[model samples]
Target: MRKSRAVMGNLLPFIIAIIFIFPIIWMLFVSLKPQGLGISNPLKWFLPPYTFTNYVHIIADFQVLRWLLNSLFVGIVTTIITLIVTSLAAFAISKINFQYKKFIFIFFLIGLMVPGEATLIPLYQIAQSMHILDSYIGLIVPGIASPLGVIVLKSFFDSVPKEVIESARMDGCSLFRIYYSIVLPLAKPALASIAIFTFIGSWNNFLWPYMITFSDHLYTLPVGIPVFNSNYSQDYILPMTVNAVSSIPLIIAFFFFEKQIVKGISFSGIKG
Candidate 1:
């Protein structure tokens, strides 16, 4: 009975992984099916009629590369800006004593309960008034002040040993030095987790980008893929292919930094 339970425990992760990954694998297989190949039986996808035509046609016909680049740029820029601003704010709130600090933190926590859609119209108006609409600045600026990012980093910062911070202070280390050198280095796992989540959010964000960007040139994959699908409504394979292409970057990112994600979540939960 003990041996059976141990074996089941070890097998559980593999089972869960297969369950999660099965849909992505199925999507890829469906996308690879040759054009004109009807899905009379889903199992037929395993046969010899697979072709690269859908991928080739989408790449050659659609501006997938441009959309991909736009998403990549927006995602990376948003992640970087979010990390920098939130980390500094978190460090100050977590470590440095200030009047009304608790109130400020409570305000940020309130923001977490507010749905993002509730502020879209106001944010859109502000962007329009600032003349940043249809620009990269418009795409990148709105997501920078992430309350969740601040809260996560603050929790991680709070978990850092107070002794280490005091020792640095005694050595005449400036707050900036302590933040850049000490806190940041210690919070790598949390930072990595936040980066992954922020980047993915920005990349997958469709409604805001769609509302803000009128020009086709500025459309990210999340916006562009749907447009492409609508344009080629008759071609079922093309949409799937485009979707598969759009997902590659996210998959690659998770594959490389999955460990950091797990570690960061674990560590952040320690104090929060």
Candidate 2:
């Protein structure tokens, strides 16, 4: 009975994973199908007779390429900006004993609990008032410091040994030197984790970009996919192909960084 139960437990997860993965599998299959195959009976969509036309169609579509570049720029910029700002802020909160420390930490922690949707209207108004509506700055400035990133790095920095800082200071090292040479180097795993989170969030962001980005030029992956899908509803396979192609970079990044990502999260919760 015990052996049977253990086998069942393992098999059960495999079955669940298959169920969850089926849609993406179906999408890839459909993507390989030609335009003629798109309008075929729903049941027949999975059969062979695949073509490369979907990918071809996207390549021929120049606007999609431009949109890809725009998103790439935004996502990369967002990741860099957030990583630097959050790392510095986390370093400060952990190292400096300033007035209102508890209150400030709590204030930022509250940002984590506040849903983005709830804050959208006010953010839009502020962006408009600041004359940054429909600009990349509009998207990036608001997203510079994530509450979770700060919290993650704060704990990681706290785990950093004070003796190291003292030793460096005894050698006449400045705060910046200590952060750059000692602390940030040791916290590489945590920083990588933060970079991945920020990149994925910015890459897949739809709602805020959709609201702020007035031109067709500004659509990111999530938003761009739907627009192209609607425009080419007769060829739904194209959008599926685009999505598959778009996810490739992220999937590859995760494959390589999975260990670092997990370790970062783990260390954030640990003392050393």
Candidate 3:
């Protein structure tokens, strides 16, 4: 019974993974189908008449490359800024003792409960007032306020030995030095997790960029792809092609950072 249970435990995760990944696999196959062929029949999707025609047409006709570069830029910038801000905030919350520290930590926790959609109107007004609309500043700046990263990193930081920090202080290490040298090195897994999550979120973001950006040049992949699709609404292959293209970066990111993701989430859970 124990052996059977163990086998079931191992098997369950694979089953779940397949369930999640199956759609992406289907989308890839559908994207490869000739322009008019895949939409009518689902079963014919995997059949042998595949070509790169859709990819070629989309790349040549649309601003997809520019959109791709825009998404990459925003995602990378957002991830970097979020890591720096959240790590510093997390370090302060975890290591430094001050009045109302618990209150400040709880304030950040409350931010996690607030839905991002709720802030869109205010954010839009603020961006409009600041004249940052239709710019990279609008796309990248708002996303850096990451409560989730602070929460995750704080949990991991809590797991670090207080004695080590004290020793560093005793040895005349400044707070910034301890944070830069000791805390960050120990929090690599947590930071990696936050970085991946931030990048993916920024890359996949459609609504904010769509609302803020007026120009095609400023549009990110999620927003830009749909504009491309609107013109070719009847064609299934083209939509799938853009989706596949948009997904490729994220897929590559996950493939390379899978270990870091798992390790980070595991550490967060255990430490939290």
Q: What are the RMSD figures for all models against the true structure?
A: 3.6, 3.1, 4.0
Q: What's the residue-level lDDT of 73 in candidate 1?
A: 96
- lDDT value for candidate 1? 0.87
If the candidates were sorted by their TM-score against the true structure, best first, what order would they fall in? Answer: 2, 1, 3
Q: What does candidate 1 score on TM? A: 0.85
Which regions of candidate 3 are displaced past 4 Å?
1-22, 36-42, 259-272
Tens digits of lDDT, candidate 1, 16-83: 99999988887788788888766777678767678888888777764887898899999999999999
lDDT of 1 at 74: 94
Candidate 3 per-residue lDDT, tens place, 54-84, comes to 8887678658889988999999999999999
lDDT for each candidate structure = 0.87, 0.82, 0.87
lDDT of 2 by residue, 1-272 (tens): 99999999999999999999888788888788877453547767788788887788777788788777877899999989888888888898998769999999899888877778898999899999999988889877887856788888888899988888888889999999988888898888788887876787788888998888878887776778878778876666777888887876777888888886676567446522
TM-score of each: 0.85, 0.88, 0.83
Local lDDT at 240 for model 1: 84
Error of 2 at 66 (Å): 1.8
| Candidate 2 lDDT (Cα, 0 to 1) | 0.82
Which of the predicted structures, 2 or 3, would earn the higher lDDT when compared with the native? 3
**Candidate with more favorable, higher TM-score: 1 or 3:** 1
